[model samples]
Target: MLIKTFSYTSLFLSFLLVMTGCKDEDYALPVPKSELQNDAIKRTLGPNLVGLDIEFAYAMAILPEKGKIVSAQVEASIAGATGTYLEHRSYYTNGSGEDVGVEVAAPSTTTGATSSVTFNRDTSAATLRYFYRIPEEARGKTVSFTFSAKSSNGESVSYAMGPYTITNMDMKLDMVATDAAACYISIEDMAIYTAAEAAANPGKIDLVYLHRTPTGLTFNHALVSPAADPQYLPGVTLPAGVNRSTKVNKVWNLRDFHLARLQYGVYIDDVDFQELNLEGAPNFAINVRAEAGVWAETADGRYRAYIYVNKVNNGAKNATISMKRYTMP
Candidate 1:
């Protein structure tokens, strides 16, 4: 198989060289540092309620698949950020040309990043996000995102991207993660770290952990670069023909999941630590929590999945739970 290596200096040169063999595959000009992610607030058609003067709503283009929506949160390269970005999210609706302005708070202080932005909307579509405003000075800079999403089923999707720019943030790329299924994202609190804090904390940028459920059925929930790999890169590979340049955005691993729910809520219970004894992986515990279960799916379906939280630990601390998800098959 042929290969290509991209870099800031060689980006231009590589582009020109690759263009020679380019096959007119559709691709987005890369999201400036951060790509648009889905907000976690769900929309429901009220059985009997007021829908008038409904200026408190907005529709997200990311329509998640049927019976999805569990513990959905957005992630990106947000390390060493100056100020906090949106963590928890909500939405509002308005007629065309009407802007729904909102004020938000950061995530609650906890092991994992989050915001106390609990979005409870009673509308068709609600906009859940920590809408960013690239100040005049901050514009034209670089950024990226580390996102997380889940369906009622145990299946989950997480990704990382960018070093994108602030200028020219307009985007239109179909390599979008969410397909016919509408995506649910909880863009919660961000830890806008200081240079001192980031420097003091080495590997903070590279450190990653996975969220688990109350039941200890899932193992290796935290994502790793590779099995038995000293350095785990949480990206996937695809056929070259499918995308001009295939990007390993997210890797969804389905383990031994045999629960009885179609569309359930998500909660964290314990953080299953990984065994860092892999030659060079430093000895450390992953950060995670379990949660309460919600809307689950039937016993049979396509999107069904089992979890794989890190069981590579010394059996010292019990994993923590936070959010739980009811899945469908």
Candidate 2:
């Protein structure tokens, strides 16, 4: 009996030891070796449009004991526009949560598709920003970037970012549409035409703008298709071939920042145009107010557009408009 009790006690002790030893493994923080390392992050949001900047933050780090950062460079798949550049400063966040920039390099230089900066500071770590202005040639295409950094110790590191797609939409801003001759808008040409011009190119006229203070009615501002009813068109005479039936739908409170150029952060991307439904929509937007907009589609289904009314002058009978147009498949 004594021997059996001793055997049972030993078995229980072994079980306890096994349970104590079966804990999860300990996690170790990664420590960089004596070499340079690089990482890149895209900071710009929304659709990549033409004539706008695509921003990136590139960080390169090495132990001060190892070596100092010598230079950094970014190579784009396609050459950017004239305003493309790399910042010569390194940035860090302050206690107030604001970014503080410190000079770390001379002005960057660009040659062909690459922009580079040579570090003038003796620091071993830095985060630089690169702004690539989307060129006209990069529209409707994909662009990628390779970010590289070198150290005084002859070690180099590189990081790759995106093959981000550039949008195909066209944008025009601050077009004046008046109650007089310059009231005809052509989405294909992205221009406002006079009465004679509309008559000359009747097929290009998509929408007509007019302001009427008719008695006992509130038709302050309106946009009507050429083939709209006479009541919506007021006193205007349509050109001979300006009878295409356009589709229009009015919307409110959707303030697109790109079109409105206002404080709102809203953006209308390519997907909005692709997913817009104008089936059985009307051909006229009456009493349109400032900050309101409309979705319009051409009669032949070749183009889709969003027209934003930036401002309307009731006394002068004019409006400032902006548009974003997309071509249909």
Candidate 3:
């Protein structure tokens, strides 16, 4: 009986030891030294196209006791276009979810591939935005950025951003095409030409825009190739040398935001143009409505284009259009 009692006592002690070992313990994080720090993020989405802004937010911070920000700069791998700039203002979100900006530095200055902004206010932390307008030289190429910040206490920090690729497709927006005037479109030049202009560059004319109200038919806004059938080109005469047999196919409900600038979030990238198959497609698109579009290919098969109808003015017999063109190899 004494032996059994001793065994029970030993088991009770082992249970107590196990409970003590499972007790929670206090912990603390290691403190880091105060220093200048910077981070960057790309804010723009979709294909980085030429003539559009590639936006980034550069955030820099230092402990209040450390020092004030001296200056900030961004160096692009390839020089941006003339309009590229770094905003000197810092933005913060307000209660209404709107971004409110405050001036924390003087206006920025750009030289070559570098843009710099110097702080004028007493600020230890700020988030600045940089807008790099993709240049013609950067087309079909990759570009990167180095964002840096310097503090008054002789400390500096830099953050590197992506080598983003620029799309080869070209975009032109808000072009007006009036019936029988400025109606000829050239995908090579990406512009609308009048009858005289089309006559001068007849070979470049690919598509013709017209608004006709023919009897027994509903052809309000139409995009007809220069070589389309006579029935589709009612009351119209083709300019001399404008006889390319271009191909066109109509599409509905494709409101690409980049082209239509509408509420829809759809986008057309390079692959869309590459994968587009226009074999056996029609040469004319009739009764085109706002937000509607067409897929077109030049006669020589050198360029493929997407023409988007932004708006149509039936009373004025005109339409606002935009285009995205891709050059085929």
TM-score of each: 0.23, 0.84, 0.89
lDDT of 2 by residue, 93-204 (tens): 9999999999999999999899999999897999999999999899899999999999999999999999999998889999999997699999988899998899899988
Instruction: Report how far off residue 284 is in candidate 2 (Å).
Output: 0.9
Question: Which candidate leads the pack in TM-score?
Answer: 3
Off by over 4 Å in 3: 1-33
Candidates sorted by TM-score, best first: 3, 2, 1
Candidate 2 runs further than 4 Å off: 1-34, 95-97, 239-241, 263-265
Model 1 Cα lDDT, one tens digit per residue, 227-246: 22332222322112111110
Supply candidate 2's per-residue lDDT for 183.
96
In Å, residue 327's CA in model 1 sits off its true spot by 54
* Clashing residue pairs for model 2: none
lDDT of each: 0.28, 0.92, 0.94
